[model samples]
Target: MVRASTPSTWLQGLDIPSQLFGTTGGSDYELYEEDDEFVLTIDMPGFETDEIALAWDDGMLNVAADHTDENRGRKKTYHRRFRFPKTVDDEGIAAEYTNGVLEVRLPTADSTAQGTEIPLEG
Candidate 1:
């Protein structure tokens, strides 16, 4: 089982602009293994394709999004990171975002755990 970090509650409990815009609430994500691949699903309520960015570095997957309301001067940003396992094929990973959800597919590397049977000498 894999779990992503959640937004700090202490940050949301405070009443400051910097806190509100900084470490406040964030989008939710779910991860699971499917066949020979791992799937990640994130919920993004009000974000455009252009506002989101994805990156992979140091065996970690990073996602960041920023949004601002022009008329209200309100801004919100969401960021999340996921660490890939050694069995994952990071090079072939793919992602797509639509209908307020982001989906990432990470294919697993070729099976390397082989088994061999040995006959007992009588």
Candidate 2:
């Protein structure tokens, strides 16, 4: 099985693709800290805004979307959870979906996330 030599918690709990399933590298979502907040963006095409659901509990944020086509007899579902290092201002969280992209802004008290990135050795 192939495995990615990446940090377990890239950008503080950002989940990358599993190499066990023949995938590797960074996560599907883009996460960065700026303006005292962590901005996360994920490309989730083919799912309507009404079908997507988001919830926050403590430091964990859950994103889920499901779409079913009766005529085609098919269902598509996507779900992911993100955990942040700093205490998130849950009330300040905002999300927007447009053109098959989902963007979420998680406000944090810190300007940078905690932890040091380990340098990879050749």
Best by TM-score: 2
Report RMSD (Å) for each prediction in the order shown. 6.8, 10.4
lDDT of 2 by residue, 1-122 (tens): 11234544553355545555443333467788887888988889999999999999978999999999899999999888878765788889999999999999998854465568889999
* Per-model TM values vs. the true structure: 0.69, 0.69
Choose the strongest candidate by lDDT. 1
Tell me the lDDT of model 2 at 17.
51
- lDDT, candidate 1, residue 63? 93
lDDT of 2 at 39: 90
